[model samples]
Target: MSGPPPAAVTVHAPLRRRVTVQGVVQGVGFRPYVHALATALDLSGNVTNTPEGVVVEVEGDPAAVARFCDRIAVDAPPLARVDSVHHQEVPATGDSAFTILASRADGPTRALIPPDTATCAACLGELADPRDRRHRHPFVTCTHCGPRFTIVTGLPYDRDQTTMAGFPMCAGCAREYTDPADRRFHAQPVACPDCGPRLALLVRRADEAGQPSPVTDGDPIAAARRLLAGGAVLAVKGLGGYHLACDATDPAAVERLRHRKARGDKPFAVMAASVEDIEPLVRLDPEERALLTATTRPIVLLRRRTDGPTVPGGLRPAEGVAPGSPDFGIMLPYTPVHHLLFGLPGDPEGPRLLVMTSGNLSGEPIVTDDAEALERLAHLADAWLTHDRPIHVPCDDSVVRVCDGRPLLVRRARGYAPLPLPLPLEVRPALAVGGDLKNAFCLGAGRRAWLSAHIGDMDDLATQRAFERAVAQLESITPVRPRLLAADRHPAYRSARWAVRNAAGRPVVRVQHHHAHVAAAMAEHGLDGSVPVLGVAFDGTG
Candidate 1:
C-alpha cells in the first residue's frame, strides 16, 4: 500500500559557489545589488569589494545558485559595467544570511574606476522637494551617480579613500548607508546637509590687500546669483576643477572673460538648465538632444539658429560666446551645485544660461587647489564660489559632437577617461606618452588600453607635473606595467623627451606623426593591420 512507503524519500545536498566579477564594479553599488539578489533567491552569501574586483560566495539550492550567478551580470546595477563573471562550485558553508563585507585591500589592484556621472533624477527630485532632508543640498548624490574618478585617491573605493573622508556620516546618513534596503547603502560620497561640505562665497576685498574674503552673512548661492546678474565673473569650484562662470546672455560679460583669459575668439561652451532652455538657440535632432542630456553631460556641438529667442532686455547668447562659428558648444547642468546655480522654482531668478569655461590662464592647467585658485584666478574672477572638498585630480569637461546620427568625441575627459578600449589583437605591456598638444597618455596590456583624462599640453611645467601624476595614478589601479615606451618621433616634443628621460632602461619607440595618425584610426575601427590600406593625413601644417 501507498507505493511501498513513497520509496524512502531522498534529499539533495545544497550547492555553494565562489564567484569573481570584474569591471566597473567597485563604486557602482555592485555589492548591494549582489546582496539583494542573493537574499531574494533565499541564498546565503557574502559580497565584498577587493582591489581586484567584487567577490561573492553563496550557498543555496542548486537551481537558485545558478540563477544567482546568471543574474549577477545580466541584472547588475545600472551604473555597473560587468565585463566578466566567473563562478565555481564549493562546499556549502551553512551560513544563515547574506552580508556585505568591508573592502579587502591586500592585492594587486585591477579594478576599473568609474568615470564621474551627472547627478541622477532621484537625487534631483530630493534636491527640489522641500519636505526632503537633502533639499537644496549641493552635494546630493546616490550610488547611481556623482563623483568617482576625480574623487578617488586609492583602490577598493571606500569613503576613507575619497574626498568625502573628512566628512563623517551623521547618525541618519550612517543608518541609510548600512541598510541594504536603502538606496544610499555603501555610497562612498553619501552626505546630508547636517554633516556635509558647506558652500562659501569668496571675494577679493580691497581692505584685505586683494586677498579672498569669505562671505559669512548671506546665502552663498544667492550671493553668487547676484554677482552673475551684475555681470561679474565667478570662479566656481566643481567636481574636478574650477570653472569661470558668467552670464552668457550678457555680451559685456562674455567679452570681459575672453579678454581676461586672452582667448582669441575661440568658441566658449555654455551651460543651461535643460534641453528646452537651449532648444531655441540650437538645432537639436533626437540624437543631439539625447547627447546633450546624457548622464556624462559632455559639451555637445549643435548647429546654431541664426534667429533664436532672446531673453529679457533683448539679450541672447552674446556673439563673443562663439565668434564666427556655425555651432554652439552647450551642456546641461551635471552637478547639484550647477543646478543650484540656476535657481530652483519659486526662488529668485538668476542667470538661466552661463558661460562655463575652464578656469585657467592662457596655456595652463585648470586650477584645482582652492588656495591656488584664489591666487591664480583672482585677476579673472570677480568672486569665488567654492567648497571645502579637495579634488585629488584635475579633470576638464569633455566635448562631443553628433555626426551621422552618432556621437563623435572631440575632447575626451571627465565622463570618459581611464575606461579601457579593447584592442583587436593582444600586445605586450607598453606606455605611450602622447604628443605635446592634448597630452592624454595611454597604458596598454594584453588586449586593453587605458587612456588618461585630458592632460593639458606639455609646454608648461604645471601640465607636465599633472601628466606625471596622472600616469602614476593610472598605473596604481591598473595591471599594466609598461616594459616599453612609445613617443612621437619629433625630437623637440616635450612628451617624447619625458618618455626617454623616464624610460628606466626600457626601449623607447619613436612613432612618426602622420603614420601614428593612420594607425590610431585603424585601431579605432578594429583593424588587424594584416591587409594593406590607403590612408590620408591632414593637419594645420599639411
Candidate 2:
C-alpha cells in the first residue's frame, strides 16, 4: 500500500537577501574571511563594513545562501570571534559576483573595534628572510595582523587614517597591498625596508644635529642586545606608548629607574622572554599561559612566586609592577623587535627579559615623542631605544587580571579602548567623561559605546590636551553627535570642568563616581536598576 510513500515536494523561490553580520567584526580579519566564504559559495554580492557590522547582499542558490549566511560564525578566522549574523530577504539587485567593498561611514556603529594583534607567522618568516625587504624590520605586519586601535586615528582603517600615513608604501609594497591573493592586501601598516619606519638610537646632546648613535649596524638586533647587556636604561617606543626598560637582574639599574621616575613604593613590571621565564617568576597553570599569549598582548597580573630562590628583593618585581595593587602585571613582547631583542647573538644568558614600564612618572601619560621623552625622562633613562615611526595617537598599556572568575580591567588602554561596548539602553547621543584616574571618554548612541583610549587623567595641561585630542579624533570615526555630556560629581575632578567647558550646547549630567562604576557593571550584567540594589561602598574616604 506504501508503494510510493508520498511524492516528494520541493519548494523553490528566487529570493534575494541582505545579511548584516555583527559583533567584533572590524579589524578582526572579517573582510578577508568573508571574501573567502563568498568566493567559496559562488555568491553574487558585495560585503562592506558599516558602523553596525559587515553588510552583505548575497544573491545565489538558496541552499548556498543558507550555508553562506549560517556557516560564517563557524568558519570565522581564529582571531575573528563573531557573535551574531542576521539575514533577511530583500529585493535583489542583479549583481554578477560578490565583491568586498571599502567600509562605509554613515551606518550604525554597533560593532566592536578589534585590538592590535600579534605578528602573523607569514610576517614572522619574512622578518628573518634576508631576501625579503622587511628582513629584521621591527614593524612588519599584514592585513590579518598588526597594530589596530593604537595606531588608527579614525575608522575605515585605511593607510591614510593611520600612523603609516607619513610613510607611504613603495611600488613593490603597493602591488602587494593591492593584490587580494597577497597577505598584505588592505594591510594599512604595510611597509618594506625601502619605505618603512626605521629605528634610531638617541643620546641627550646639546645640539639636535649632534649624531647620538646609529642603531643600524650590521645587525640592529645584535646592536640592541649589546646596548641592553651593558646595564644601561633604554627608553623604548612600544605599541601603546614609550617604555623605560632596564636589566631585571641588575638591582642597581632597576632601583635607579624606580627612583628617577619618583615612583617611590610602586611596583615595576617585568617583560619575560617566554612562558618558561614566566613560570619561574610566577605560578601559572594552562589558563594563565593562554591569557598571557593571547593576541591582545595585555599585562596579565599574576601572583608572585613565593618559593623561587634568588628572587630580586625590594626591586619587588611583582609588587612594583602593579603598585598599590594586589596582583603582578606581567606581559610578553608583542613585536618582532621584542622577539629579536631576546634572541640576541650567541644566546646570551643575562635574563632575556627586563623591567619594562611606562616611560613616565606615576600618574602621567606615556611618552611618545623622542624629544619629549628625553626632556621628561632624561633622568629616568640613561639611553634611548627609539624608532622613527611617528605615533599618531597615544595609547597606554592595558592591564588585566582574573577577578571573581572574570577578566577584570585594571588599566584599559592601547589594546582595549576605542572598541564599541554593547550598551543596555539605546540612549540619545551622549558623552561620558570617565574617571579622572585611568581616564577615558565614552561616546554612545543607540546600543554602541565607543570608548576612547586611556587618556591618563584630567590632572595636568598635557593630559587635558590629550583628552581633547582623543575626543576629536574619535568623533571622526563615529556617526553620533553628542547632545549631552556626563561627568563625575567629584569637586576637584578636572574631567567635570572639561565637560562643563567643552560641551557648549550640551547639558552635563553629574553622576557620582562610584555610582557610575556600579551602573557600568549593572549594565554589562543586564541587571534592572528599578529595584533597590545592595552593595558595600568603598569610597576610599574613611
Candidate 3:
C-alpha cells in the first residue's frame, strides 16, 4: 500500500576526515580542547597547529566522525573563535589513540591569535593557595588564561615564538606541560618563579635626566607599595604598556600625576583591588559586575553610587576621580602583579584603589620601550615598578560600558583585539583604514573581517608606526592580502592619506562617512538589496 514499504536504510562504513579550522584557535588551549573532544568521541588521530589554522584528523564511526566535526566548532575552548571550518572525508587509518602533534609551518596562513586574557579563576585560586608551588607567582598562567596577543611574536603561537622563549620551563612545569590530563598541558606561557620574568622597583634620581636606580635589597612589591602609599607616582608596566599609577584616594597625588602628565581634567581609569573594594564606590548591576570580572578585564564605565558608605579616605567620585562626569571608569586587577599591588588579603596598609592611567605625555603613544619610559616619564613618575618581560606591541586597555544591559564598546583593544568580527557579505582581500581619530583598521577576506586593536590618533609618528606594525601583524595571522583597499573619504584625514600611500598600486575606494556606516549596517543585517530597511546614524560631531 504505501509505496513498496520504504526501502531498508543502509549503514555507512567507518569514516575518516581532515578538518581545517580557521580563526583565533592558536594560543588558546585549542589543541587540548580538540584532544578532549576526539577522545570523548572515541575517535583516533591527531590535531596540530598550522600557519593556516588548526588541523585535525579523526577516524571513527561515520556518525561519530560527523559529530566530532560539529562539536569542534560548537564546543570549542572559550577563547577559540571558529571562523570557518572545512572538512573532507578521507580513507580510514587504523589509528588507536588521539594525540596533539607539534605545530607545522606548511599550510595556509589564516589562523587568528587570541587576545591576552585576564587570569582565570583556577589560576587565581592556585595563586592564593600557599601549598601550590606557583603561589603568588606573577606570571602564573595555565592553558585557560594569561598573555596571548601581547606576548606572541609570531604565528603558530608556541613558546619559542613568544617572549617566554627566553625562560625555559622548570622540571615541575615541564611535567605539567607534557601531561595530557594537566590544565597547562601545552600552555605556551607556562612558567614558575624559577624560570619567569623578574620584577624590580627603581627609584628615580633627583637629576631629571639621570637613570633611575633599583631600591636596595627590599621586596619590590613592598617597596612599590610604600612609595605609592607615600603619595609617590609610579610608572607600572602592564600587559601592553606602562601605566602611571598612584593612590586614587590621595587627592594631592592624583593632582600631581595629572599635572605632570599634562592631562587636563580627563577622567582617569581606576584599578580596584577587588569587587569589595569598588562596590561601595560604584553602583554595579549584574551586567556591570559580569563585565568587571570577565576574562577580558576591560575598564568598565559605571554610574557612580549616590548613596553608600564612603571608602576609607571618603574620596568622592567627583572629588578627584571623574570630575564632571556621572560615571567612573572602573577595572579590577587583571594581572597577578596588579593583585599583588594591593597586598594579600587581611592586609590593610596598601591602597585599595589606584588611578591607573596610561603612561604617556599628552598626544603621544603609550610608552612600551623601557628606556623610552625612563627618559619620558622621569619627571612624572617618582619610581618605576617594571619587569624584564619585553612588550612586543603596545596595546591600550579596552574601554566598555553597559547600555540597556549589553556592553557597548567605547575603545576596543588589548583584551578584545586580534579577534575577527563576522562579515555578513563576502568581500575580496582588502584593508580598510579607519578614521584618523579613533583609528582602528580592518582587514577583510571572504566573509570575515578583523578589526585591529585601537590605534590612537594617527597624527603622532609613533602612533602611525604602531598602526603599520599592527596591520602587518594582523596580516601575518589573517592571510588576507589586500588586493583592494578602502579608506575614509575625508581628504585631509591622515589615515586616508596613509591608505593612499600604502596602496602599492592596489585599487583604493573612498567611502563617505555616512555611506560607510549604512553599508556596514546593511551587511551586518544580511540585507543583500532584495529588501529595504530604514537606518539611522548619529555621529559625535553632529
Candidate 4:
C-alpha cells in the first residue's frame, strides 16, 4: 500500500539566469523554441537574436531554470544547431511573461549562420500535393529547409537581409509566418505562388545583323526539359548559382558541352530524379545512399557497375559522362525546381538523368550574376532557365566521396559555407589564403575558422575578382577583421601574391605547402604534438 505524499513546500525566492548561445542559431527558429520552452516551464523570460547568437533570460525556480537551460539544445528545432551555450546566474528582473525581442545588430558577429539545406519532407510533401497552395511552387520553403548563407547578403539573417526580400508574402503566407503552430512561422524564405520568385526561360538566336539576341518566354521548367530532351544545353539557376545541365544519356550533348566549355577529361556530376532512377547504373552502399539523400545534397562519387547489369537493370549512364574514371559523381534533385524538371509522379517522357556541371568556363569561377552568365556562357549554353531570386554568393556544388565507409569531402561549398571549423588552439584574427590551385581562403578568430566557398583557380583575372568579392562577403558575415594574413610559401602562386598585394598593413606569414598539409591533418585530429606521426606528401609537384 502506498502512503499519502507529504505536503509540498513552495520556494519563496525566484532564480534568474542569462544564457548566450553561439553557432547556426539565427534564422533557424531559435527564439520561438526558446519562448515555447520557457513558457512550458512556467518561467518568465525573454529571448532575442544577437550578433553573438541567441540571448535568453529566465526567472523561475532554480531547478526549473536549470532544466530549461539544459534542454534548450536537446529540444532545439530540427534546423536549430546549438554549438555552445553559456549561462550565468543574474539578479531576478521580476518579469511576468516570456517574450521574443527584436534582433540586435551592434555586437561582433561570432554567430555562425547555417548553410542552405535541401527541401525538407514537409515542404516536399506540399510541393507534390495538388491541393497544397504551394504545390509545384519552385521557391517553396519552410524553417527546416531552403536557402541561408548563399542568399544572405548581410548579418542578422532575416528575410530583408536575404534575396527573398524582393518577394512579399501573401495573406496566406503571412498567416503562416505569424502562427506559432505553423512550421513556416518565422521562416525567412517563406512564400507561395501568390508572391514568390518565378522562373523565366530564354533562348539565344542570331539577329539579322548576326548579333546574338536572347528571346525570353516560356513555362521555364517545361521548356528547359524540352530543350534538354532535344540535346540542347540549358544554363539553370540553382540555389547557390547556375548549373549547365543536359541529358546525361546523350553522348553528343555531353561532348558538345565539354567542347564548348573547354573542359578536359574531368567528369561531370549527374543529377537524377531520385535514388531509384540511378540505382541501376551505380553501386550504392548504405553510406553512399545517405550522403546522396542528405539535406546538403552533395555530389557523391560512387563506383560504377562494371560487373554486368545491376540488380534492377534499367539504362546505363553514357560513357561520355565520366570518360576515364571508374566512379560516377551523382546527386539527387534538391530544389523544388529540380523536382519540376523531372515532372510530377507519372508523366514521364523527359530524360531520367541530367549532366549537371558548374555553370562556368573551364578556368573561371561559377557564374552567379545573371547578366554575366548571358555574356560569358553565351558560347556554351543554348538556353537559360533562370529565376528572379538573386544569389548573393556564388558557391559551387560540394563534392564528396565515401572511402572505407566514411565521407571524404573533396570540395566544400554551397551547402557548407560560412560554417566554422573548430581549431585545436585559439588564435588571433587571421586570414589564411589557401593555394591558388584549389583556392579556398579561411578567416579565423579564437578557435573557429571559416573557409570561403570554392573560389576556383586564382590564376584567371575573373577568379581573382571573385576571390576579393567572396572575401568581402565573408568578412561582412563573420566579425573577424583579419589583423594577420597567411598564405602559401610558393613565391609565384597567385594566392600568395594576392596576399602580398592586399595585406594592407597586416603581416603576411608564408607557410610551406607540404608543411601546411601535415599541420592540417594534425589539427583535424586534435593532436597536441606529444608524439611523432608519419606523414607522406604526394601532391605530384616535382
Best by TM-score: 1
Ten consecutive residues with minimal summed lDDT in candidate 1?
1-10
For each candidate in the order shown, give its overall lDDT on alpha carbons: 0.90, 0.74, 0.85, 0.86
Candidate 4 to native Cα RMSD, angstroms: 3.1
Best by lDDT: 1
lDDT measured at residue 231 in model 2 versus the true structure, 0 to 100: 70
Clashing pairs in 4: none
The CA-based lDDT of model 3 is what? Answer: 0.85
The candidates, ranked best first by TM-score, are 1, 4, 3, 2
> Candidate 1's residue-wise lDDT over 1-542, tens digit each?
44555466666688999999999998899999998999999999799888989999999888899899889999999889988998898888899999988889988878899999999999999999999999999999999999999999998899999999999999999999999999999999999999998899988775546577789998899899999999999999998899999999899999999999998989999998778778778788999888878889999999988785554445478889999999999999999999999999889877888999999976688899998998889899999999998899789999999888889888888888768999988888999999888778999999999988788878999899989988998998888999999999998999999999999999999999888888878888899799898989985321
The C-alpha RMSD of each candidate to the native structure, in angstroms, is 1.7, 4.5, 5.0, 3.1
Write model 4 residue lDDT over 311-373, tens digit each, in one string. Answer: 244556677889999889999888998888988775557777899999998768999998888
Candidate number with the higher TM-score (2 or 3)? 3
Off by over 4 Å in 1: 1-10, 307-315
Position 361, candidate 1: lDDT? 78
Give the true-structure RMSD of model 2.
4.5
User: How would you encode candidate 3's per-residue C-alpha lDDT over 1-542 as one tens digit per residue?
Assistant: 45677779887777899999987889888898889888989999999999989999999888999899888989988888787899998888888999889889876777888889899989988887888888878888898888888888887889998888888888988999988789998999998989889988899765465578887686888889999999999999989999999998888998898889878888999998878878877788999999999999999998887887377556443266677778889999889889889887655578888999988876667888888889888888999999888888678899999989989888888798877777777789999998877678899888878888777778888888888888887887778999988998888888888889999999999998877778776875577667776767777431
The ten-residue window of minimal lDDT in model 4 covers 209-218
